[model samples]
Target: MDFSDTIGVSAAGMNAQSTRLRIAAENLANKDTTATTHGGDPYRRKTVTFKEELNRQTGVSSVKVKEIGQDQTPFEQRYDPAHPAADAKGYVKMPNVNSMVEIMDTHEAQHSYEANLNTMQITRSMLTRTINLMK
Candidate 1:
Protein backbone atom coordinates (compact mmCIF):
# COMPACT_ATOMS: atom_id res chain seq x y z
CA MET A 1 0.00 0.00 0.00
CA ASP A 2 1.06 3.57 -0.59
CA PHE A 3 1.48 6.35 1.94
CA SER A 4 -2.04 7.61 1.33
CA ASP A 5 -3.50 4.17 1.85
CA THR A 6 -1.52 3.78 5.07
CA ILE A 7 -2.89 7.11 6.29
CA GLY A 8 -6.41 6.11 5.30
CA VAL A 9 -6.21 2.84 7.16
CA SER A 10 -4.83 4.59 10.23
CA ALA A 11 -7.63 7.16 10.09
CA ALA A 12 -10.22 4.41 9.97
CA GLY A 13 -8.62 2.74 12.96
CA MET A 14 -8.61 6.01 14.85
CA ASN A 15 -12.27 6.52 14.09
CA ALA A 16 -13.19 3.08 15.37
CA GLN A 17 -11.18 3.64 18.56
CA SER A 18 -12.82 7.02 19.01
CA THR A 19 -16.23 5.34 18.99
CA ARG A 20 -15.02 2.80 21.51
CA LEU A 21 -13.78 5.60 23.77
CA ARG A 22 -17.11 7.36 23.51
CA ILE A 23 -19.04 4.23 24.44
CA ALA A 24 -16.74 3.60 27.37
CA ALA A 25 -17.26 7.17 28.56
CA GLU A 26 -20.99 6.75 28.26
CA ASN A 27 -20.91 3.54 30.24
CA LEU A 28 -18.85 5.25 32.95
CA ALA A 29 -21.21 8.21 33.04
CA ASN A 30 -24.23 5.96 33.58
CA LYS A 31 -22.52 3.65 36.00
CA ASP A 32 -24.48 4.98 38.94
CA THR A 33 -27.81 5.23 37.18
CA THR A 34 -30.56 3.20 38.77
CA ALA A 35 -33.93 2.09 37.51
CA THR A 36 -36.66 4.67 37.75
CA THR A 37 -39.31 2.15 38.77
CA HIS A 38 -39.00 -0.65 41.26
CA GLY A 39 -37.99 -4.01 39.76
CA GLY A 40 -37.28 -2.33 36.46
CA ASP A 41 -34.03 -2.73 34.58
CA PRO A 42 -31.38 -0.07 34.98
CA TYR A 43 -28.86 1.12 32.42
CA ARG A 44 -27.14 -1.82 30.80
CA ARG A 45 -23.48 -1.58 29.88
CA LYS A 46 -22.81 -0.64 26.27
CA THR A 47 -20.40 -2.63 24.15
CA VAL A 48 -18.68 -1.82 20.90
CA THR A 49 -18.32 -4.33 18.10
CA PHE A 50 -15.94 -3.78 15.22
CA LYS A 51 -16.04 -5.21 11.72
CA GLU A 52 -13.58 -5.21 8.87
CA GLU A 53 -14.65 -3.01 5.98
CA LEU A 54 -13.07 -3.07 2.56
CA ASN A 55 -12.53 -0.07 0.37
CA ARG A 56 -13.28 -1.40 -3.08
CA GLN A 57 -11.32 1.26 -4.93
CA THR A 58 -8.25 1.19 -2.73
CA GLY A 59 -8.48 -2.54 -2.07
CA VAL A 60 -7.87 -1.77 1.59
CA SER A 61 -9.50 -3.29 4.64
CA SER A 62 -10.15 -1.07 7.62
CA VAL A 63 -11.97 -1.37 10.89
CA LYS A 64 -15.51 -0.09 11.36
CA VAL A 65 -17.99 -0.14 14.23
CA LYS A 66 -20.40 -3.00 13.69
CA GLU A 67 -22.78 -2.16 16.49
CA ILE A 68 -23.15 -0.53 19.88
CA GLY A 69 -24.94 -3.32 21.68
CA GLN A 70 -26.01 -3.65 25.30
CA ASP A 71 -24.22 -6.04 27.61
CA GLN A 72 -26.57 -8.85 28.67
CA THR A 73 -24.86 -9.30 32.04
CA PRO A 74 -27.25 -9.35 34.96
CA PHE A 75 -27.35 -6.34 37.23
CA GLU A 76 -26.20 -6.49 40.81
CA GLN A 77 -28.65 -6.05 43.65
CA ARG A 78 -27.91 -3.75 46.55
CA TYR A 79 -29.67 -3.37 49.89
CA ASP A 80 -30.94 0.16 49.77
CA PRO A 81 -34.21 0.26 51.62
CA ALA A 82 -34.39 4.04 51.67
CA HIS A 83 -33.83 4.36 47.93
CA PRO A 84 -36.90 5.29 45.92
CA ALA A 85 -36.42 2.46 43.44
CA ALA A 86 -35.94 -0.20 46.02
CA ASP A 87 -38.01 -3.35 45.59
CA ALA A 88 -40.35 -4.88 48.12
CA LYS A 89 -37.47 -6.75 49.72
CA GLY A 90 -35.51 -3.47 50.08
CA TYR A 91 -33.14 -4.48 47.31
CA VAL A 92 -32.28 -2.17 44.42
CA LYS A 93 -31.12 -3.32 41.05
CA MET A 94 -27.96 -1.50 40.10
CA PRO A 95 -26.57 -0.81 36.65
CA ASN A 96 -24.47 -3.52 35.06
CA VAL A 97 -21.65 -1.06 34.35
CA ASN A 98 -18.44 -1.74 36.23
CA SER A 99 -16.30 1.32 36.73
CA MET A 100 -13.00 -0.51 36.69
CA VAL A 101 -13.84 -2.33 33.50
CA GLU A 102 -14.96 0.90 31.87
CA ILE A 103 -11.79 2.66 32.92
CA MET A 104 -9.70 -0.13 31.49
CA ASP A 105 -11.62 -0.02 28.26
CA THR A 106 -11.06 3.73 28.08
CA HIS A 107 -7.32 3.31 28.51
CA GLU A 108 -7.15 0.62 25.89
CA ALA A 109 -9.12 2.68 23.40
CA GLN A 110 -6.93 5.70 24.05
CA HIS A 111 -3.82 3.69 23.37
CA SER A 112 -5.24 2.28 20.17
CA TYR A 113 -6.23 5.77 19.03
CA GLU A 114 -2.77 7.07 19.75
CA ALA A 115 -1.19 4.21 17.86
CA ASN A 116 -3.27 4.92 14.79
CA LEU A 117 -2.54 8.64 15.05
CA ASN A 118 1.14 7.89 15.25
CA THR A 119 0.92 5.69 12.19
CA MET A 120 -0.77 8.48 10.27
CA GLN A 121 1.82 11.02 11.40
CA ILE A 122 4.70 8.78 10.42
CA THR A 123 3.14 8.05 7.06
CA ARG A 124 2.67 11.77 6.48
CA SER A 125 6.27 12.46 7.39
CA MET A 126 7.48 9.77 5.03
CA LEU A 127 5.39 11.19 2.24
CA THR A 128 6.75 14.66 2.92
CA ARG A 129 10.34 13.38 2.91
CA THR A 130 9.74 11.59 -0.36
CA ILE A 131 8.42 14.80 -1.93
CA ASN A 132 11.35 16.82 -0.64
CA LEU A 133 13.81 14.28 -1.98
CA MET A 134 12.27 14.63 -5.45
CA LYS A 135 12.62 18.47 -5.39
Candidate 2:
Protein backbone atom coordinates (compact mmCIF):
# COMPACT_ATOMS: atom_id res chain seq x y z
CA MET A 1 0.00 0.00 0.00
CA ASP A 2 1.18 3.55 -0.74
CA PHE A 3 1.92 5.83 2.17
CA SER A 4 -0.26 8.64 0.79
CA ASP A 5 -3.26 6.39 0.18
CA THR A 6 -4.51 6.79 3.73
CA ILE A 7 -4.65 10.56 3.40
CA GLY A 8 -6.53 10.38 0.13
CA VAL A 9 -9.06 7.87 1.47
CA SER A 10 -9.65 9.77 4.68
CA ALA A 11 -10.11 13.05 2.82
CA ALA A 12 -12.81 11.51 0.68
CA GLY A 13 -14.62 10.19 3.74
CA MET A 14 -14.41 13.58 5.44
CA ASN A 15 -15.87 15.32 2.41
CA ALA A 16 -18.79 12.92 2.23
CA GLN A 17 -19.52 13.25 5.94
CA SER A 18 -19.40 17.04 5.71
CA THR A 19 -22.02 16.93 2.99
CA ARG A 20 -24.14 14.64 5.12
CA LEU A 21 -23.96 17.00 8.06
CA ARG A 22 -24.88 19.97 5.88
CA ILE A 23 -28.02 18.20 4.62
CA ALA A 24 -28.99 17.19 8.14
CA ALA A 25 -28.62 20.77 9.31
CA GLU A 26 -30.74 22.00 6.44
CA ASN A 27 -33.49 19.58 7.37
CA LEU A 28 -33.40 20.79 10.96
CA ALA A 29 -33.42 24.44 9.96
CA ASN A 30 -36.47 24.03 7.74
CA LYS A 31 -38.31 21.72 10.07
CA ASP A 32 -40.97 24.30 10.90
CA THR A 33 -40.91 26.52 7.84
CA THR A 34 -44.38 26.83 6.33
CA ALA A 35 -45.61 28.17 3.05
CA THR A 36 -45.33 31.92 2.57
CA THR A 37 -45.88 32.83 -1.07
CA HIS A 38 -48.98 31.85 -3.01
CA GLY A 39 -49.13 28.20 -4.08
CA GLY A 40 -46.04 27.46 -2.00
CA ASP A 41 -45.85 24.27 -0.02
CA PRO A 42 -44.29 23.89 3.41
CA TYR A 43 -40.60 23.07 3.59
CA ARG A 44 -39.90 19.39 3.10
CA ARG A 45 -37.18 17.47 4.83
CA LYS A 46 -34.09 16.53 2.83
CA THR A 47 -32.02 13.36 3.06
CA VAL A 48 -28.50 12.42 2.05
CA THR A 49 -27.34 9.17 0.52
CA PHE A 50 -23.83 7.80 0.19
CA LYS A 51 -22.42 5.38 -2.35
CA GLU A 52 -19.11 3.68 -2.93
CA GLU A 53 -17.10 4.45 -6.02
CA LEU A 54 -13.78 3.17 -7.33
CA ASN A 55 -11.09 5.85 -7.50
CA ARG A 56 -9.91 5.97 -11.08
CA GLN A 57 -6.23 6.31 -10.27
CA THR A 58 -5.93 4.54 -6.92
CA GLY A 59 -8.43 1.76 -7.59
CA VAL A 60 -9.63 2.23 -4.02
CA SER A 61 -13.26 2.20 -3.03
CA SER A 62 -14.30 5.61 -1.81
CA VAL A 63 -17.52 6.87 -0.36
CA LYS A 64 -19.30 9.69 -2.16
CA VAL A 65 -22.61 11.43 -1.68
CA LYS A 66 -24.99 9.69 -4.09
CA GLU A 67 -27.63 12.37 -3.80
CA ILE A 68 -29.29 14.90 -1.63
CA GLY A 69 -32.97 14.36 -2.13
CA GLN A 70 -36.30 15.15 -0.58
CA ASP A 71 -37.83 12.79 1.97
CA GLN A 72 -40.73 10.86 0.44
CA THR A 73 -42.38 10.34 3.81
CA PRO A 74 -45.67 12.06 4.38
CA PHE A 75 -45.74 15.55 5.84
CA GLU A 76 -46.90 16.01 9.40
CA GLN A 77 -50.24 17.54 10.29
CA ARG A 78 -50.86 19.67 13.36
CA TYR A 79 -53.94 21.26 14.70
CA ASP A 80 -53.36 24.99 14.45
CA PRO A 81 -56.49 26.83 13.59
CA ALA A 82 -54.96 30.29 14.11
CA HIS A 83 -52.06 29.69 11.75
CA PRO A 84 -52.30 31.31 8.34
CA ALA A 85 -51.47 28.19 6.36
CA ALA A 86 -53.74 26.01 8.44
CA ASP A 87 -56.42 24.06 6.66
CA ALA A 88 -60.15 24.57 7.11
CA LYS A 89 -60.24 21.54 9.41
CA GLY A 90 -57.93 23.31 11.88
CA TYR A 91 -54.83 21.46 10.68
CA VAL A 92 -51.50 22.80 9.42
CA LYS A 93 -49.10 20.79 7.32
CA MET A 94 -45.69 20.51 8.91
CA PRO A 95 -42.42 19.30 7.53
CA ASN A 96 -41.70 15.63 7.94
CA VAL A 97 -38.51 16.35 9.92
CA ASN A 98 -38.41 15.22 13.53
CA SER A 99 -36.09 17.15 15.82
CA MET A 100 -34.97 14.12 17.78
CA VAL A 101 -34.16 12.16 14.65
CA GLU A 102 -32.28 15.04 13.08
CA ILE A 103 -30.18 15.62 16.16
CA MET A 104 -29.28 11.95 16.33
CA ASP A 105 -28.34 11.92 12.66
CA THR A 106 -26.25 15.04 13.22
CA HIS A 107 -24.40 13.30 15.99
CA GLU A 108 -23.66 10.29 13.83
CA ALA A 109 -22.44 12.47 10.99
CA GLN A 110 -20.22 14.44 13.35
CA HIS A 111 -18.68 11.21 14.64
CA SER A 112 -18.02 10.02 11.13
CA TYR A 113 -16.39 13.34 10.24
CA GLU A 114 -14.18 13.17 13.32
CA ALA A 115 -13.13 9.64 12.52
CA ASN A 116 -11.98 10.70 9.07
CA LEU A 117 -10.12 13.69 10.50
CA ASN A 118 -8.35 11.42 13.01
CA THR A 119 -7.30 9.06 10.24
CA MET A 120 -5.78 11.94 8.30
CA GLN A 121 -3.90 13.18 11.36
CA ILE A 122 -2.53 9.72 12.11
CA THR A 123 -1.41 9.27 8.54
CA ARG A 124 0.37 12.61 8.60
CA SER A 125 2.16 11.71 11.82
CA MET A 126 3.25 8.38 10.37
CA LEU A 127 4.56 10.07 7.26
CA THR A 128 6.44 12.61 9.34
CA ARG A 129 8.07 9.86 11.39
CA THR A 130 9.00 7.90 8.30
CA ILE A 131 10.69 10.96 6.83
CA ASN A 132 12.56 11.65 10.08
CA LEU A 133 13.89 8.09 10.15
CA MET A 134 15.39 8.56 6.69
CA LYS A 135 17.19 11.78 7.69
Candidate 3:
Protein backbone atom coordinates (compact mmCIF):
# COMPACT_ATOMS: atom_id res chain seq x y z
CA MET A 1 0.00 0.00 0.00
CA ASP A 2 1.05 3.57 -0.60
CA PHE A 3 1.38 6.38 1.96
CA SER A 4 -2.14 7.69 1.37
CA ASP A 5 -3.64 4.24 1.84
CA THR A 6 -1.74 3.73 5.07
CA ILE A 7 -2.85 7.14 6.35
CA GLY A 8 -6.45 6.48 5.31
CA VAL A 9 -6.53 3.15 7.11
CA SER A 10 -5.06 4.68 10.25
CA ALA A 11 -7.56 7.52 10.11
CA ALA A 12 -10.42 5.06 9.86
CA GLY A 13 -9.10 3.12 12.84
CA MET A 14 -8.79 6.33 14.87
CA ASN A 15 -12.34 7.28 14.03
CA ALA A 16 -13.63 3.90 15.21
CA GLN A 17 -11.68 4.11 18.46
CA SER A 18 -12.91 7.64 19.10
CA THR A 19 -16.48 6.50 18.71
CA ARG A 20 -15.81 3.68 21.17
CA LEU A 21 -14.31 6.12 23.66
CA ARG A 22 -17.31 8.43 23.33
CA ILE A 23 -19.73 5.57 23.98
CA ALA A 24 -17.76 4.47 27.02
CA ALA A 25 -17.76 8.02 28.34
CA GLU A 26 -21.50 8.26 27.83
CA ASN A 27 -22.05 4.99 29.71
CA LEU A 28 -19.84 6.15 32.59
CA ALA A 29 -21.62 9.49 32.81
CA ASN A 30 -25.02 7.80 32.93
CA LYS A 31 -24.00 5.10 35.39
CA ASP A 32 -26.01 6.64 38.22
CA THR A 33 -28.90 7.79 36.08
CA THR A 34 -32.10 6.11 37.15
CA ALA A 35 -35.48 6.33 35.51
CA THR A 36 -37.54 9.35 36.49
CA THR A 37 -40.74 7.32 36.53
CA HIS A 38 -41.37 4.60 39.06
CA GLY A 39 -40.85 1.05 37.76
CA GLY A 40 -39.55 2.40 34.44
CA ASP A 41 -36.50 1.07 32.71
CA PRO A 42 -33.21 2.71 33.67
CA TYR A 43 -30.46 3.83 31.34
CA ARG A 44 -29.09 0.98 29.28
CA ARG A 45 -25.37 0.80 28.49
CA LYS A 46 -24.42 1.62 24.89
CA THR A 47 -22.22 -0.63 22.78
CA VAL A 48 -20.15 0.00 19.63
CA THR A 49 -19.91 -2.37 16.71
CA PHE A 50 -17.27 -2.19 13.97
CA LYS A 51 -17.11 -3.45 10.41
CA GLU A 52 -14.40 -3.62 7.78
CA GLU A 53 -14.87 -1.83 4.48
CA LEU A 54 -12.86 -1.92 1.32
CA ASN A 55 -12.13 1.07 -0.90
CA ARG A 56 -12.61 -0.44 -4.33
CA GLN A 57 -10.59 2.24 -6.13
CA THR A 58 -7.69 2.29 -3.66
CA GLY A 59 -7.89 -1.41 -2.94
CA VAL A 60 -7.52 -0.58 0.75
CA SER A 61 -9.44 -2.02 3.69
CA SER A 62 -10.43 0.12 6.66
CA VAL A 63 -12.48 -0.11 9.80
CA LYS A 64 -15.87 1.49 10.19
CA VAL A 65 -18.49 1.76 12.96
CA LYS A 66 -21.33 -0.56 12.08
CA GLU A 67 -23.71 0.55 14.78
CA ILE A 68 -24.17 1.99 18.26
CA GLY A 69 -26.61 -0.25 20.06
CA GLN A 70 -27.93 -0.74 23.56
CA ASP A 71 -26.57 -3.50 25.76
CA GLN A 72 -28.98 -6.39 26.37
CA THR A 73 -27.84 -6.89 29.96
CA PRO A 74 -30.58 -6.49 32.51
CA PHE A 75 -30.61 -3.46 34.77
CA GLU A 76 -29.67 -3.84 38.41
CA GLN A 77 -32.12 -3.36 41.26
CA ARG A 78 -31.37 -1.27 44.32
CA TYR A 79 -33.49 -0.83 47.35
CA ASP A 80 -34.13 2.85 47.95
CA PRO A 81 -37.47 3.27 49.56
CA ALA A 82 -37.43 7.06 49.77
CA HIS A 83 -36.22 7.63 46.19
CA PRO A 84 -38.68 9.09 43.71
CA ALA A 85 -38.12 6.23 41.26
CA ALA A 86 -38.63 3.49 43.76
CA ASP A 87 -41.29 0.99 42.84
CA ALA A 88 -44.09 -0.26 45.09
CA LYS A 89 -41.74 -2.93 46.39
CA GLY A 90 -39.19 -0.21 47.35
CA TYR A 91 -36.71 -1.26 44.68
CA VAL A 92 -35.39 1.14 42.10
CA LYS A 93 -34.13 0.09 38.69
CA MET A 94 -30.47 1.02 38.32
CA PRO A 95 -28.47 1.58 35.15
CA ASN A 96 -26.62 -1.43 33.77
CA VAL A 97 -23.37 0.52 33.45
CA ASN A 98 -20.46 -0.70 35.56
CA SER A 99 -17.80 1.90 36.43
CA MET A 100 -14.92 -0.57 36.35
CA VAL A 101 -15.93 -1.96 32.97
CA GLU A 102 -16.38 1.52 31.56
CA ILE A 103 -12.97 2.56 32.83
CA MET A 104 -11.35 -0.48 31.21
CA ASP A 105 -13.16 0.19 27.95
CA THR A 106 -12.02 3.80 28.00
CA HIS A 107 -8.42 2.70 28.59
CA GLU A 108 -8.53 0.22 25.73
CA ALA A 109 -10.07 2.72 23.32
CA GLN A 110 -7.51 5.36 24.25
CA HIS A 111 -4.67 2.96 23.54
CA SER A 112 -6.16 1.94 20.22
CA TYR A 113 -6.64 5.57 19.22
CA GLU A 114 -3.06 6.34 20.15
CA ALA A 115 -1.81 3.40 18.14
CA ASN A 116 -3.69 4.54 15.06
CA LEU A 117 -2.45 8.11 15.52
CA ASN A 118 1.09 6.81 15.80
CA THR A 119 0.68 4.85 12.61
CA MET A 120 -0.52 7.91 10.75
CA GLN A 121 2.34 10.00 12.09
CA ILE A 122 4.87 7.39 11.05
CA THR A 123 3.40 7.21 7.58
CA ARG A 124 3.54 10.97 7.25
CA SER A 125 7.16 11.02 8.42
CA MET A 126 8.08 8.37 5.90
CA LEU A 127 6.38 10.30 3.14
CA THR A 128 8.19 13.48 4.14
CA ARG A 129 11.56 11.72 4.14
CA THR A 130 10.87 10.28 0.72
CA ILE A 131 10.05 13.71 -0.63
CA ASN A 132 13.21 15.16 0.91
CA LEU A 133 15.32 12.42 -0.59
CA MET A 134 13.80 12.96 -4.04
CA LYS A 135 14.60 16.70 -3.82
Candidate 4:
Protein backbone atom coordinates (compact mmCIF):
# COMPACT_ATOMS: atom_id res chain seq x y z
CA MET A 1 0.00 0.00 0.00
CA ASP A 2 1.09 3.57 -0.68
CA PHE A 3 1.75 6.23 1.99
CA SER A 4 -1.20 8.20 0.61
CA ASP A 5 -3.45 5.25 1.40
CA THR A 6 -2.36 5.37 5.00
CA ILE A 7 -3.15 9.05 5.14
CA GLY A 8 -6.56 8.48 3.64
CA VAL A 9 -7.35 5.72 6.08
CA SER A 10 -6.24 7.82 9.04
CA ALA A 11 -8.24 10.79 7.78
CA ALA A 12 -11.33 8.65 7.56
CA GLY A 13 -10.78 7.40 11.11
CA MET A 14 -10.37 10.94 12.36
CA ASN A 15 -13.61 11.98 10.71
CA ALA A 16 -15.48 9.09 12.32
CA GLN A 17 -14.06 9.85 15.75
CA SER A 18 -14.91 13.52 15.32
CA THR A 19 -18.52 12.60 14.73
CA ARG A 20 -18.51 10.34 17.78
CA LEU A 21 -17.06 13.09 19.93
CA ARG A 22 -19.69 15.51 18.71
CA ILE A 23 -22.48 13.11 19.61
CA ALA A 24 -20.97 12.46 23.02
CA ALA A 25 -20.76 16.17 23.67
CA GLU A 26 -24.35 16.62 22.67
CA ASN A 27 -25.41 13.85 25.05
CA LEU A 28 -23.44 15.42 27.88
CA ALA A 29 -24.96 18.83 27.23
CA ASN A 30 -28.48 17.45 27.33
CA LYS A 31 -28.01 15.13 30.29
CA ASP A 32 -30.19 17.08 32.64
CA THR A 33 -32.88 17.92 30.13
CA THR A 34 -36.40 16.77 30.85
CA ALA A 35 -39.50 16.61 28.72
CA THR A 36 -41.35 19.86 28.19
CA THR A 37 -44.76 18.39 28.94
CA HIS A 38 -45.86 16.05 31.66
CA GLY A 39 -45.71 12.30 30.87
CA GLY A 40 -43.76 13.00 27.67
CA ASP A 41 -40.56 11.28 26.69
CA PRO A 42 -37.30 12.97 27.58
CA TYR A 43 -34.15 13.26 25.50
CA ARG A 44 -32.67 9.96 24.41
CA ARG A 45 -28.94 9.40 24.28
CA LYS A 46 -27.56 9.38 20.75
CA THR A 47 -25.13 6.80 19.47
CA VAL A 48 -22.93 6.67 16.37
CA THR A 49 -22.42 3.58 14.26
CA PHE A 50 -19.50 3.26 11.86
CA LYS A 51 -19.32 1.36 8.58
CA GLU A 52 -16.42 0.50 6.31
CA GLU A 53 -16.25 1.76 2.73
CA LEU A 54 -13.91 0.88 -0.10
CA ASN A 55 -12.37 3.61 -2.20
CA ARG A 56 -12.57 2.21 -5.73
CA GLN A 57 -10.18 4.79 -7.17
CA THR A 58 -7.45 4.25 -4.56
CA GLY A 59 -8.41 0.72 -3.56
CA VAL A 60 -8.12 1.73 0.07
CA SER A 61 -10.66 0.94 2.74
CA SER A 62 -11.97 3.65 5.08
CA VAL A 63 -14.54 4.15 7.80
CA LYS A 64 -17.72 6.20 7.63
CA VAL A 65 -20.63 6.96 9.92
CA LYS A 66 -23.42 4.45 9.29
CA GLU A 67 -26.08 6.00 11.49
CA ILE A 68 -26.85 8.06 14.56
CA GLY A 69 -29.40 6.14 16.60
CA GLN A 70 -31.07 6.64 19.93
CA ASP A 71 -30.09 4.65 23.04
CA GLN A 72 -32.67 2.10 24.16
CA THR A 73 -31.96 2.56 27.86
CA PRO A 74 -34.87 3.63 29.98
CA PHE A 75 -35.00 7.15 31.38
CA GLU A 76 -34.34 7.87 35.03
CA GLN A 77 -37.07 9.06 37.29
CA ARG A 78 -36.21 12.13 39.37
CA TYR A 79 -38.40 13.54 42.06
CA ASP A 80 -39.14 17.12 41.12
CA PRO A 81 -42.66 18.02 42.11
CA ALA A 82 -42.26 21.71 41.36
CA HIS A 83 -41.06 21.16 37.80
CA PRO A 84 -43.54 21.61 34.97
CA ALA A 85 -42.44 18.37 33.35
CA ALA A 86 -43.20 16.30 36.42
CA ASP A 87 -45.95 13.71 36.19
CA ALA A 88 -48.86 13.33 38.60
CA LYS A 89 -46.66 11.16 40.78
CA GLY A 90 -44.19 14.06 41.22
CA TYR A 91 -41.53 12.27 39.21
CA VAL A 92 -39.84 13.72 36.11
CA LYS A 93 -38.32 11.63 33.43
CA MET A 94 -34.65 12.50 33.10
CA PRO A 95 -32.53 11.93 30.03
CA ASN A 96 -30.87 8.53 29.82
CA VAL A 97 -27.44 10.10 29.33
CA ASN A 98 -25.03 9.18 32.10
CA SER A 99 -22.28 11.74 32.71
CA MET A 100 -19.59 9.24 33.68
CA VAL A 101 -20.29 7.07 30.66
CA GLU A 102 -20.24 10.08 28.36
CA ILE A 103 -17.00 11.34 29.87
CA MET A 104 -15.32 7.97 29.36
CA ASP A 105 -16.63 7.77 25.78
CA THR A 106 -15.37 11.29 25.07
CA HIS A 107 -11.95 10.36 26.36
CA GLU A 108 -11.86 7.22 24.25
CA ALA A 109 -12.87 9.19 21.14
CA GLN A 110 -10.19 11.78 21.85
CA HIS A 111 -7.56 9.07 22.08
CA SER A 112 -8.72 7.55 18.80
CA TYR A 113 -8.65 10.94 17.09
CA GLU A 114 -5.18 11.66 18.41
CA ALA A 115 -3.93 8.27 17.23
CA ASN A 116 -5.31 8.84 13.72
CA LEU A 117 -3.77 12.32 13.62
CA ASN A 118 -0.45 10.85 14.64
CA THR A 119 -0.70 8.27 11.90
CA MET A 120 -1.42 10.96 9.31
CA GLN A 121 1.46 13.09 10.56
CA ILE A 122 3.87 10.16 10.41
CA THR A 123 2.72 9.26 6.89
CA ARG A 124 3.20 12.85 5.74
CA SER A 125 6.66 12.91 7.27
CA MET A 126 7.58 9.71 5.48
CA LEU A 127 6.36 11.13 2.16
CA THR A 128 8.32 14.32 2.72
CA ARG A 129 11.49 12.41 3.51
CA THR A 130 11.05 10.30 0.39
CA ILE A 131 10.73 13.41 -1.76
CA ASN A 132 13.73 15.03 -0.09
CA LEU A 133 15.85 11.92 -0.69
CA MET A 134 14.80 11.84 -4.37
CA LYS A 135 15.62 15.54 -4.80
How would the candidate models be sorted by TM-score, starting from the highest? Answer: 3, 1, 4, 2
Better structure of 1 and 3 per TM-score: 3
C-alpha local distance difference test of each model: 0.93, 0.85, 0.95, 0.94
**Per-prediction TM-score to the true structure, in the order listed:** 0.96, 0.92, 0.97, 0.95
Per-residue lDDT of 7-107 in model 2, one digit per residue for the tens? 88899899998998888899888888987543346888888888998977877887888989988888888887788787768687788899999999989
- Candidate 1 C-alpha lDDT tens digits along 8-69: 89999999999999999999999989988877888899999999999999899999999999
* Runs off by more than 4 Å, candidate 2: 37-40
lDDT of 4 at 100: 98
- Give the distance in Å from residue 82's predicted Cα in candidate 3 to where it truly belongs: 1.2
| True-structure RMSD for candidate 4 | 1.0
User: In candidate 3, how many Å is residue 126 off?
Assistant: 0.5
The residue-by-residue lDDT of candidate 4 on 1-135, one tens digit each, is 899799889999999999999999999999988889878888999999999999898888999999999999899999999988999989999999999999999999999999999999999999999999999
Give the per-residue Cα lDDT of candidate 1 at 37. Answer: 80
Residues 12-99 of candidate 3: C-alpha lDDT, one tens digit per residue: 9999999999999999999999989877898999999999999999889999999999999988999999988999999999999999
Best-to-worst ranking by lDDT = 3, 4, 1, 2
